[model samples]
Target: MKERVQKALDGIADLVWPRICAVGACSRAVDRPGRHICSGCYSTLPFYAPGGACRICGAPVAAKVSHLFTCETCTAAPPCYERTCSVLAYEGVAEELVKAFKYNRATWLAEDFAELAEGAVRAELDSHSVDVVVPVPLHPNRQRQRGYNQSALVARSLARRLNRRMDESSLVRIRDTPKQSLLGGSERRKNLKGAFSVVRPAFVRGRAILLLDDVTTTGSTLAAAAEPLRAAGAAHIWCATIARAASTS
Candidate 1:
């Protein structure tokens, strides 16, 4: 009875102070429990159709070959991770969400992104056979300056939703490379090479790892991060990003 009374009280208080959508006012109320975005705004967000994307790289492929085979790009140069999934396209409102999490340090948005991502990622997560979740590491100095690693924040929520153990400490950014956004494809890959390392091989060895990133543009960052895990003997590495960009570089 006491617990019920507290629940009722909380509900009453919430009614007085309803949760608003994270995006600037169209004044839509957030009704999804533990998420900040409302249905109307969320519907406008550019979500990828999971079924029509490459099973290996999450790139959109011709409808006939989507799940049946690797896309031509992946066939020519396969990424380090075995498979990938993304929740949204990196455009318009979706891009704003990612930028808010990244540059603006809207840490609370991670929860909302994770909630949006779970359904989009569930099939890939299931297919990947992951035993652990790992977030791409940010250089310690950058993390210190930013006050948080947005990738890790998203990964933490994703791990909780998927019931996987999250190992934030296993992956370390050994070198602080410049932002990949400003670089060409080759330059991005070159910059990220040897940037990451595994602090604890024992933790990852023989485990299927799910790597999480907030956004993937050219796949260079994810590939670079996966190499260290591969060397550490992670049996298989799968990746998921909240958004996929149309290659700004």
Candidate 2:
């Protein structure tokens, strides 16, 4: 009875106060009345093809080789994480939505973002192997200022959808590093070299970690965070992000 009542309340709330959708104004017609984004918009969002993508980094590649589409950079120097996935190209409305979530504290869009990510992850990976979900953590000060970690919200939603354990406290950001967006790749790597540490190593040991984040440009931050988990004996680390910046190099 309580569950039914709660469902009724939720339905009433949706009817009374619909959430602001994420589809752009031009695409508003594509959205359903109370949803975050319309099915059409969701369909139109850019998706990286699973084929001809780097086996390790998951970046798009021109051709496949040796049962993997290895990006040139990954071929030269590999990232720490075993695999990575992204939903959209980091531009236009996608970029704006990410900025709003991370800096403006527009957490209402998290569910929509998670839905998009979940689809991409399922398409790219076999879900049965995933054991835990971990969000990239922010330093305490930044987290307080922002009112929440956007990554954590996404991670929680993903955990619920996948019916997997969430280990938010397993990994932590011990150092406050300068923002990497403005820096070059080398500097970004330097900025994040020692920024992350695992708090409860036992929680992640022998488990496959599904790491969530908002975006990836140089991938320094994700790699840095993965280092600690890798050191703690994580079996496999797979990263998922909302978008990826197009690399000029």
Candidate 3:
């Protein structure tokens, strides 16, 4: 009865306060509670199973191996990060939303994206024990140009929802590397090689860190960041991204 009354009060508060629409103020009415996105747009967002993904790389897999989402490539050659988790496949509306967030500076849309990312993080929390959330760093030059890092926004949202510590200062990007999307796998690896270094080793030492990024194409950038964390004595590192491009090869 007490819980029911509290829920009613919450509903009343929401009605009075009213959430601002995420798609911008056309002022369309939103029926769903506790969501900034309208019901229509929320339904349009893709959701993939957290299970049945490659444990090591977070790619979609045909079967469940001993490692969560370990596909054939990951089985043959392990990635630098121990594992990865992601919410949506990299295609369709997911790709568009991410692009808008990164390039257009759709800061308001982050609320909706964060909700989705937090759901993914929460699903994996029990299975994979995460001690800290670290956003993949951007080079100071690029970050200055972009004005914001989308990965950091996602990380901050996940951290708030999970009640975990976030270390935006731990990893530093030492060089402004070329975009990984434009390069082939080998070139991507070379582009990001030695690009990241640990700034505060003591904070990460003996801790299980959860690295957050917006997307993973070849995962070379993630591996580059993970290498420094590993050297700094991080006990374990897991990665999570909003999207992953399905490998054609």
Please tell me which model should have the higher lDDT, number 2 or number 3.
2
- Give per-model TM-scores: 0.89, 0.88, 0.82
Weakest 10 consecutive residues of candidate 2 by summed lDDT: 26-35
Off by over 4 Å in 3: 1-27, 32-35, 62-69, 125-128
Q: Please give the lDDT score at residue 73 for candidate 3.
A: 74
> Which pairs, if any, clash in model 1?
none
Best by lDDT: 1
Candidate 1 to truth, TM? 0.89
lDDT at position 88, candidate 1: 90
> Per-residue lDDT for 52-94 in model 3, tens only?
7666776665654455445777788787788777777778777
Ranking by lDDT: 1, 2, 3
- Deviation from native of the Cα of residue 33 in model 1, angstroms: 2.3
**What lDDT would each prediction earn against the true structure?**
0.82, 0.81, 0.79
Q: What does candidate 1's lDDT look like per residue over 1-249, in tens digits? A: 975786687577668988778787557778765567888898888886644766687767545443367777788988778988888988888888788889997777988888876776786567337788899989999999998999899888778788888899999999989888888878988999899999999999999998989888878888999998999899999888999987655
Best by TM-score: 1
lDDT of 2 by residue, 1-249 (tens): 975786588667867765445654643432343246667666766665534667677666655554756677877887778888888888777787778887876787788888888988898876678999899999999998888989899898888789898888989999998887778888888889889999899998999999988888767788999999999999999999988887553
